[model samples]
Target: MKNLILSTAALALTAGIAMADTVRMGTEGAYPPYNFINDAGEIDGFEREVGDELCKRANLECEWVKNDWDSIIPNLVSGNYDTIIAGMSITDERDEVIDFTQNYFPPAASAYVGASADVDVTTGVVAAQTATIQAGHVAESGATLVEFATPEETIAAVRNGEADAVFADKDFLVPIVEESAGELVFVGDDVPLGGGIGLGIRESDGELRGKFDEAITSMKADGSLNELIIKWFGEGVPTYNADGSVVTN
Candidate 1:
C-alpha cells in the first residue's frame, strides 16, 4: 500500500528516538497530487513524502489523520495532532499561530475563468523572474473586495456575482473551471502571487521542527524532491534541473 517507511526513518529524537514518538499528522486529504485520498482510499501525494521524511529524520513514528482543510489548524491547536503536512501556504498571518520549517514546495496561485472568454489577463507588472495569470474579471471601480476562506467558495462566488473574480491556486482552479456553469476563466497579466507551502506544527514542537528541516535538506540534496515534482506537475512546478540548478524564474 506504499507505506512510507521501508524501515523506521532514521529516528532523530533529541535524547534518542522517543519511545512514545507516534507523531500525529494533519492533512486535508482533498488536494490531489499533493495530499489526497485516491479512489482506493490510500492517502498519497508530495506532502505525504514530506511527512515520511520528517518522521525518519526525527526518529519518530507517524499517524496521519486526514481532516478538512478549514478544520486542520483548529484541531492541531486543540492538541488533536502533532504536525500539519497539508499544502498550507506560509504567510505572516499563519505564522502568528504556528511555526514552520523551511518551505519544501513553493506553489503559485492563479485565477481561472470559463474557456469561452477572450480576456487577456497577463498584463500586470512583469518580473524578469516570474510568470503570472490573472483574475478574469476586473473589480467594479471602488467595489469592495471579499476574500473567501477556501478556493472552491471563491470560484462559486465569482460565478454568482457575489464577487468579480477568484484568486486561487492552479491546482484547485483549473479543475473547477472545466465544470463551472458560468464563464470560468482567469486573467493572464496579473502579478504573480506566490507564497508556496511548508510543514506546520504547534509552536512548542521544536524537536519535530529540527527533524523536518533536516529531512527537507536530505530530500533536496538527493534529488528526490525534484523527481517527485516532475512526476506530479508535468515539469511545470519548479523543482530542480538535471545540472542541480533551481528551475525557477
Candidate 2:
C-alpha cells in the first residue's frame, strides 16, 4: 500500500491529484517472463520492462509491489496498489470487478505438460496454479484439478508424481520443458484462453486506465510493443499490426 501523509480531510480534497501523481503497480513477482525477483532481489522481466515503459509514456511515476498470486486481485481491490500490470488476462469474470486496458499482448494458449506424451490430461490428475484461468478450465474439463498457490508449486506437483500433468500458459511452460532435459514433455493440444494480457485497474480509476490504454495504443501503433514481445518471447509469437489487430502465422 502507498503511504500518504495527508489528514483524512486533506486527502479527500486531493484524492484525484494523488491518484495521478504516483501509481503503484502490483504483480505476482513469482511468475517469470511476466515478473520475478532477480538475484539482486529486485523485480525483473518482461512485465517490468513494459510497465516501466508504459509509466514513462503516461508521464506517471510508478513503483512496483510484489504480492502472492493467490491474493493479487483481492489486494488490488483493497487498495494495495493503483494498478495490476501483471500478466493478467482480460476475462469477463475479472472485468466484473475491475477495468482492463486494451490488451498489450496477443491471445496466448494454455498448455498441458506431463512426464510423457502419452500421459492423459482428459481424466487424469492435473495441477494448476490457484486463482488462474487454467485452474478453472481444468476443473470444468473433467480433469481432477489439484491447485497450488504458486506456479512453481504446480510444476513441482507434476515432478513429484502428485499430478499426471500440469496445465499453464504455454509461454511459461516452454522454457521449463526445454530445461527439463526430457523429464517433462508437452501433451495434448494447446487450448486458447482469455482475451490476452492487459493492465488491470479499479473500475473507479477510469482516468488511470485511460492513460495506460493510450500509452499501450501508442506502443502498438509504433511497433515498439511488438519489438519488446519478440525481445522477451522470441520469434514466431503473435504480434500486432499497425492497426492493432493481431498478426498470427
Candidate 3:
C-alpha cells in the first residue's frame, strides 16, 4: 500500500498536479503597499495582511516566501511556493499559464513619475519593471522602454536620467511622489492597465484556487475587504460591492 501511494504521488507530479500542506505564499518583497520587506526584514504590506486573512478564512496554514519579481511566476510553477500573493494583475496572457483568484485590488491606473511635470511619457524613454503590464504598455506605446529587474531600479533609472520617466502603479508611486519633496512629479495621463490584482496559483491547483476564491468572496460580502483596501490604498480608490463587483467613487 505504501508503494502504491508513492506511485500515485509520482503520477501526480508527472501530471503537474500541485497540492500544498502549508500553502506557501510567494511575493515580491520589494513592492510597497503590495508586498515588501519591513525594517524587521519580514514581509509586511497590504498583501501580507490580505493573505493572512484569506488563509485564516480558508483554514489553511500559510507562510510567505520572498522571490524576485522577474522569476516569481516561474518559481510558483516550479513548486517553490504554493500561491503568489504579490501585487500581480490578472491578464489573459498570464491566465494561460496560471490560475488567478478573483481580484482583491480594484482596477488601478499606472502613472509616470519624472524629474519634471513636462516630461513626455508617450514618446520619451520610460522605465518599468521587467515582465510587468506597464513594461508591455510602454513597449506598444511608441515609448522607448527600459526594463529593470526590480521596481526600485525602475525609479532609480529615472533619477539617474537613464530614463525620462518611470511608469508604475499609482498606489506604489503616490507615497514616493509625496516624499520626493518636489523632486519628482507625475507626468502624462494615467493609463488604466490589467484586470486588477489577484492571487496567482498554479493551473493544477484548482482546489486551492477555490479555497482562496471563497475566502475573497466572503471578505467582499462582509465589507472587511473594502476597509482593508481603503486602509492601504487610501480612500477614493475603487472598492468591491457585496457581489464582488467593483464600486468606484
Candidate 4:
C-alpha cells in the first residue's frame, strides 16, 4: 500500500500551487526510510522529515505530492510539482535535465541481495528499479538486467525467481534483508554509485534551489543533518561535515 496511485489532475490542481510562497514537494511515497505513507496516510519517513525541516528553514509553505518513480522527473519538468525530495541521487545524466541542490545525504554503497550468498550476480539476472544508477550499472556489468517500476518489485523479482538478485541502495536493503530472516542475504561486495542524494529542482528554479541549498548548509553547520542521518540510517552512516567534507567510519 506504499505506492499511492494519484491522479495527475488532483496533484497538479488541488495541491499547493507552484508559486513563490508555496512549493509542492514531490516524492515517491513507496520508498521507505527515504519516503513512505504512514498508517495515517500521510507521507512520513526520513525524506519527509528532512523536507519539512528544509521548507521551514527556507521559510516556504510546502505541501507533499506523491508521484510514481518512473515519471518523477518528467512530471517535475511539466510543472506537476516544484521540487523532487525523493531519495534521488545526484548524477551527471540527471543533472543534464534537472538541477540539484547540494547533497543532503552523503554517498552510499549499492548492494546485491539474493536467496544465496553464492549467487552469480555478475552473470545471472539481476533486478533494479528502473531509471536508477543501479539499473545502469547492472546493464553494463555483464548481468542480465531486469528493470522494475518500484523497489518492491525488484525485491519480489528475486523472491519469485524471476531474477537471481536485486541491486539497490545498501541502506534500503538492510531492513529488508533483516526482515526476511534467512530468505534474503547480501550476496556480493557493495558497489559505490552516485555522488550523493539531493533535492531535484527545475533548471529554471535557481532561486528555489539556492534556498534549499542554503537550508541544507545551515543544517550541516548546526550538526542537525548528521543527527538526522544517524537517526534514520543508524550510527556510523556517512555524512558531510559542516565544511562539506565526507565523514566516513
Candidate 5:
C-alpha cells in the first residue's frame, strides 16, 4: 500500500506541474543565429534567449512553437499561442492590433548586394522588413527598388545576378556575406524601421507586458545581452535605440 500511494502521488504532482506551465509561443525557423530550429527539431537562437528571459521576468513557464516568418502575427492573433517570441518589428500599424514589450535587441539596418558591385545609392532600395516608412522617405528623396524577402532568398538573388542589392538587419548580414568582402557592403543604417524586435503579447495581457519590458531592459544593462549578440553577430553590428539612433558599445 505504501508503494502504491507513492506512485499515485507522483502522478498527481506531474499533472499539477503541467497545469502551471506557461502558454505556447512561436517564431519563424528561418532567421539564422537569431532564431532557427535545430536538427533535433527544437527552436534555438538569440531570440530564444529573449524568450527565456521574458518568461523568467514574468515568472511564467514557456513552450516554443515554430512557424514561418510571414504567418507569425496572423497565427498569433488567432490564439495559436500566448505571444510571438520571433524577432518581429513593432510598427505603428502592428501596434494598433497587438501590444509589444520594450525594445530588447535593436539590430541596425544595413543593405547587402552582390559581392562585386559598388553600393548603388542610385537604385534606391528594398527592405526585408518592409518599406512602409522607407517608402515615404525614398519617394521624398527619390531612389530605386527591387524585390524583397528573406536573407536566404535575397542572397541567392545576388548570387544569380537577378537583383542588384538587399537591405537587411546589420546584425546578421555582417557575417553572412563576410566571405564576399567587397561584394557585400553595409551601405547605411538609415531605414525607417527602428526599435529593433519586441516580445509580442496580446494587448490584453497588461501584466505580462510590464514584466517583459522590465526583464528586457535589465538583460541589456547586465552584459548577458551583449554576450549573446557577440556570439552570433560578432563585434561589428551596433545595437540601436528604438528610433534608429546609434548606441555605443
Candidate 6:
C-alpha cells in the first residue's frame, strides 16, 4: 500500500512537470503590430515579442498557435490552447467567461476611417471586426453596423462603399490610412472602448494565469513592458512608469 501511494505521487509530479514544460500561446496572427504572420509564415509582432519574453521569464517552453479572432475565446474555453496572448481587451463580459492576467497594453482609442472626412459616422454604415468591442459599439451607436470576419474585410468594406467607414483601433488604422495615400482619412472623434489588453486563460488554470501575472509584473517593474509598447505602438502612447504610475499623453 505504501509503495503504491509513493508511485502515484511520483506520477503526478512528472505529469505536472510535463505540463509546465510547454505552454501553448494562442493569438490571432492577423492584427499587425500586435500580432501577425511574417513573410516566412511565422507569427511575428508585438504580442509575439512580449509573449516570448514572458515565457522566458517564467522559464516555460512556449509555442504559438494562430486562431481566427471571431472564435478565439470559444476555442480557448474548449481547450484549444493553454493561454491566449492575443491583443484581447479585458472587459467585464469577457471576464465572466475566462480569467485574465494583468494587462500588458494600456487602453487606447478607437477611430473611424472612411473614404471621405465628411461621412456621418453615427448614421452611415460602419464596419467593424466581428466579436470585437468596436463592433459592439457600432451596433449600439445608431449606425448601420456591418460586421466582417476579419479586420482586412472591414477596411475593404469602406473602400468598396459597402460601408461608409470602418471602426477599429487607431493604431491598426494608422498604417492603412497612410498606405491609402489620401484615399482614406480619419473621420469623427476617437472613441475610448474597453479596458487594457490582457492575456486570457482558462478559469480552471489559475496556476498558469498566476505564472504569467508574475512574469508580466516583472516586465512592468523593469520598464521592459513600456519599451515594447512604445516600440510597437510608437511614442506618446500610455504606459506605466517605473514607479507604477501611468504615463499618458
Q: Rate the local accuracy (lDDT) of all candidates.
A: 0.58, 0.84, 0.83, 0.85, 0.59, 0.83
For all predicted structures, in order, the TM-scores are: 0.70, 0.92, 0.92, 0.92, 0.75, 0.91
* Tens digits of per-residue lDDT for model 2, 177-218: 999999999998999988999988877788898999999999
- Which of candidates 2 and 6 reaches a greater lDDT? 2
Q: For all the candidates, what are their Cα RMSDs to the real structure?
A: 9.5, 6.2, 7.4, 4.9, 12.1, 9.4
Residues 1-249 of candidate 5: C-alpha lDDT, one tens digit per residue: 000001111111111122235867777766777788789888888888768876786688888888665556666666677777766666666676677887666645644444454546456343333332333333354455453435577666655666555555555565666767565665544453555667777766666677777777767667666667677777765654434344666
Candidate 2 residue runs with Cα over 4 Å from true position: 1-18
Shift of residue 232 alpha carbon in model 2, Å: 0.8
What clash pairs does model 3 have? none
> 1 or 3, which is superior by lDDT?
3
For model 4, the local distance difference test gives: 0.85
Can you give the lDDT of residue 1 in candidate 4? 12
- lDDT-better candidate, 4 vs 5: 4
lDDT of 5 at 55: 79
> Model 6: what TM-score?
0.91
Ranking by lDDT: 4, 2, 3, 6, 5, 1
**Per-residue lDDT of candidate 4, residues 1-249 (tens digit):** 111122232122222234478889999998889999999999988999899999999999889999989888778878888999988888777777777998999888889999999999889999998877788788899999998998999999999999999999898999999999899999979888887889988887888998999999999998998888888889878987788788996
What would the per-residue lDDT of candidate 6 be over residues 80-141, giving only the tens digit for each residue? Answer: 78888877888877777777998888778889999999999999999998778788788889
Q: Which stretches of candidate 6 lie over 4 Å from their true place?
A: 1-19
Q: Candidate 1: deviation at residue 166, Å?
A: 2.8
Give the TM-score (vs. native) of candidate 2.
0.92
Question: Among these predicted structures, which one has the highest lDDT?
Answer: 4
Q: How high a TM-score does candidate 5 get?
A: 0.75
Task: Estimate candidate 5's alpha-carbon lDDT, on a 0 to 1 scale.
Answer: 0.59
> On a 0 to 100 scale, what is the lDDT of residue 80 in model 4?
87
* Model 3 ranges off by over 4 Å: 1-19
